[model samples]
Target: MRTNQESKRRWRWARGVLGPFAISVLVGGSVSVSSGFRESELQCEEAYAHLEDCCGALHGAISCTYEEGCAGQTPALDVVQSKCIRKLSCSEIEALGMCDASAWRSDAGAPLCP
Candidate 1:
């Protein structure tokens, strides 16, 4: 009877003490996973705006898509290129061989214009 009572006490301790901790950890991990890409998305938007300014209005508007397990990382190369294009004047796009709206569409995996 004593052993059974001790077993019951241990089980209660595990449930009462460890359960909330486990739950909290799980919840925290989930939150991180869900929110991890938020920063990248914002950066993507900023890069898109830069592309619009340089490439032309809505020109080379890339939709930033991130790889799985790549959370809070820097924007992808294409997005980075969008920002870099800001150094180029919009009027110089054709002269510089830059195609208008040639950005890749993240969802369709194809050129935005084509």
Candidate 2:
């Protein structure tokens, strides 16, 4: 049986050690997530450079990717979408852009975005 004084001492010691450890764990996780998001954004920007008249759709995807609940789906929807656009020829990109502004629909037949 621990006395009140001993319990308080144990609590203080645990807090002293665990407080910083918990904060470090949180901060470390935050740093990695933010860095990963930034990296993905950078890649998206790079992919966007090769595209023209498609920023609207790509920007919309970027916005969604950063949205609170939507972030879980794809940390880099813009990057993935832009990469898909990059795979198309200039005429195809132009056609897709002219067809819809937020044309971010996935192909029914394909596993990835069309």
Candidate 3:
């Protein structure tokens, strides 16, 4: 059995030690989660921009090729594919564009027009 004074002193010590530790952990966790959400939002925006650029390029290429009646022309295909690859990477296909030209051609997927 401890004295009343000793019990009060122990309680105060425990509160002083545990209170700051708990607060620090809560604050740190909140900050980390907030940062992660911010980064994800920025990435989403970038992906959307890339997708729009790729779509515009594809539309232009298709219109040009169709008007010329050369849908199967290699030069038109190369130009369109090059523009598509430039706006996106192979791994970002699902996020940035739909075409998988990089996976289809090993040497022709580097976003360079010949």
Candidate 4:
């Protein structure tokens, strides 16, 4: 048989776990996201925005196409899109913002090798 003390302990633990969430019934209630969690979400949004900008900026300068020779750089920009844009550290993402487009592209519309 569970003692009253044990029941109380379980309730307390549950309260602790659910403290960050809504206290209302399941029918309807508002959740209070912790400030720290909100801040993290904001940071993620900012990072994503920066990453999107990086991809856009890089893709704009790239001249690679199915028939082009600068295809080598396509992989490089893909690196920026798949890796750097999403997984790189914030400082690195910031650096990408300030990077020169020439570094990612040798020449615009360069002819592909036959």
Candidate 5:
């Protein structure tokens, strides 16, 4: 049996991705954050970068690789939808400016943005 003093010494508070703070516990010698963490709004460039990553993971499934019979999946698509897209508002996503996108190149050697 451990005392309150002992337990207090182990667990510590961490800043959650959301505005609210959450409790983080040291498990197996590492800290594990509680669920429901939402990070702050990403800058346009940063959000674009994240979209690029998602697209990179998804592209293989969308075209060349899949057509070549090298079948692969875009795991990051869900990540982008849930983490990046959902986190940002329509205005923020619009701010990423898909049509005028110039940040990343596409699989077809064109701009990655829509």
Candidate 6:
């Protein structure tokens, strides 16, 4: 039992508050893409190189990663490492392009081509 004038005022106040919030969420949510690059590691030359190599191996996998509402398996680092060895020379991987080559090499301690 509110009067017509009071009802109009309340409606106006609710619209003024909720309208902008709803619009902002809709607009902002659309622009955000989940580029699943993990932030735990620093962005170094080696890291970028590794990312490029990994993404190259899992080109299909990367596309799968970006699919909407995708629930299937994602590519793993080991797969990328195997592909890197198969596709690129050890010297190439050892180069500065592989961001913090020392760290990656040490971590990927497996023997490469002599």
TM-score of each: 0.39, 0.40, 0.36, 0.27, 0.25, 0.33
Model 5 Cα lDDT, one tens digit per residue, 1-114: 999987765553322232242222234224334321222212333453544553433232221111124473322223344354536555555566532333323443322233
Higher-ranked by lDDT: 5 or 6: 6
- What ranges in model 1 sit over 4 Å off? 39-114
Compared with the true structure, the alpha-carbon lDDT of candidate 5 equals 0.37
Q: Candidate 6, which segments miss by more than 4 Å at Cα?
A: 34-114
lDDT of 4: 0.45
Q: If both were scored by TM-score, which would come out higher, candidate 1 or candidate 5?
A: 1
Q: What's model 5's TM-score?
A: 0.25
lDDT of 3 by residue, 1-114 (tens): 999999999999999999999999999999997765333334434433454454433232221121225554222234355354446654565453354334224354433322
Name the top TM-score candidate: 2
Better lDDT candidate (1, 6)? 1
Q: What is the lDDT of residue 80 in candidate 4?
A: 30
Candidate 6 lDDT, tens digit per residue, 1-114? 999999999999999999999999987877563334432212322334444564343222212121225574322234444444446553565452343333334345433322
Q: Would you list the clashing residue pairs of candidate 1?
A: none
RMSD of 6: 10.6
lDDT winner: 1
- Over the stretch 86-110, how does candidate 2's per-residue lDDT look in tens digits? 6777677565553343444443221
Question: Against the true structure, what is every candidate's RMSD?
Answer: 9.2, 9.0, 15.5, 14.5, 14.1, 10.6
State the TM-score for model 4: 0.27
For candidate 4, write residues 1-114 as lDDT tens digits: 999999999999988878645444432432333322333334434443554465454444443222326542222233234333455654665454424455545544321211
Q: By the lDDT metric, which is better: model 2 or model 4?
A: 2
Model 2, residue 64: distance off in Å is 14
Residue pairs in clash, model 3: none
**Where does model 5 exceed 4 Å of error?**
1-70, 75-81, 99-114
Which ten contiguous residues of candidate 6 have the minimum total lDDT? 58-67
